[model samples]
Target: MSKKIVIIPGDGIGQEITDSAVAVLKKVSDKYNLNLEFESHPAGGTAYDLCGTPLPQTTLEAAQNADAVLFGAVGGPKWDNVEPTLRPEKAVLGLRKGLGLYANLRPIKVADALVEYSPLKEEIVKGTDVLIVRELIGGIYFGDKCESEIYEGNERAWDLENYSVPEVNRIVEFAMQAAKKRKNKVTSVDKSNVLATSRLWRRT
Candidate 1:
């Protein structure tokens, strides 16, 4: 059976990067006989220009059904003045919501050969391996907000930050399981002193 990979090349350098990545995937598929199929979908400012929405329904459906999605960058100053809902950055948020994606795992590892390329000192950059697990599709990003409102006769804009125990527990459990596979350590950060949500998160 062939596996379909959805490619979402968003604005800016997205096209160039995804094109090169697809070329590499093609070579690897041919060499290993992995039977991979590639499909391109528009998103971000490009999509908004062509379809009046940062994330088209077709693109979201394709991504949801694909075996995997190779997503490129999104957002640029070109679409900064657009409506909040149709902003280029909203494409990524839409995909996360439509695909039920909640975790963003970022791995930072310095290879022996690339140590010189790092801005950090050689001693600090060398032999460094770290995994930063971030929770997406929650918090202020998905919370309620007022783009503009009147409070005490003053124009105000605010975004609510919210978190539930279950939501916190799910991500924490995932991080714990990930730690078990690595160094058996997890470091969680939050501003519990000031924010009620963070206090709940810490307690959870």
Candidate 2:
């Protein structure tokens, strides 16, 4: 069976980037006979313009059912005045929640050729390879918040910092396993001194 890849070219330079990515994927598929298929879906500001929502129901469904998803960037000055909930960036948050994406793995490695281009000193970043595992779908992004409210005659807004035991445990366990594959060292950043949620995260 062929694997279907859903391409969500959000806005701005997303179209050009995904187009080039598809060309590369096609070449790889042909060389390996991977039987890959592609489908395009609108999202971000583009989707908001076409369907009145950054993440349309149809696009979400298609993403959930696809074998893989290739997402380009989102957001630009064009949608700066849009509502916070309906902003182009919300499409990424919606997709993360809808797809149950819980972790963002960012691998940082400095290649020999790119070491000279790095802003950091050559000796400091020459052979650096680090993986940053970030938790998603359960932080302030999904927390309850008020855009604007008057409190004590002062205009203010608040975003709740929320987390669950299961959510913390899941990401911790994933990071632990990932560490075992590398240097068996995991550094989790938390501010238990000032935040109650960080305490729970550290405990779990």
Q: Specify the highest-lDDT model's number.
A: 2
Superposed by TM-score, candidate 2 places the C-alpha of residue 150 at a distance from the truth, in angstroms, of 0.6
lDDT of 2 by residue, 21-128 (tens): 999999999999999999999999999999989999999999999999999989999999998999999999999999999999999988899999989999999999
TM per prediction:
0.91, 0.94
Q: For model 1, what is the C-alpha lDDT against the true structure?
A: 0.94
lDDT of 2 at 117: 95
TM-score, candidate 2, is 0.94
Screening candidate 1 with a backbone cut-off below 3 angstroms (N, C-alpha, C), the clashing residue pairs are: none
How does each model score on lDDT? 0.94, 0.95
Worst 10 residues of 1 by lDDT: 9-18
lDDT of 1 at 25: 98
Under the 3 Å rule for N, CA and C atoms, how many clashes does model 2 have?
0
The candidate maximizing TM-score is: 2
As a whole number from 0 to 100, the lDDT of residue 55 in candidate 1 is: 95
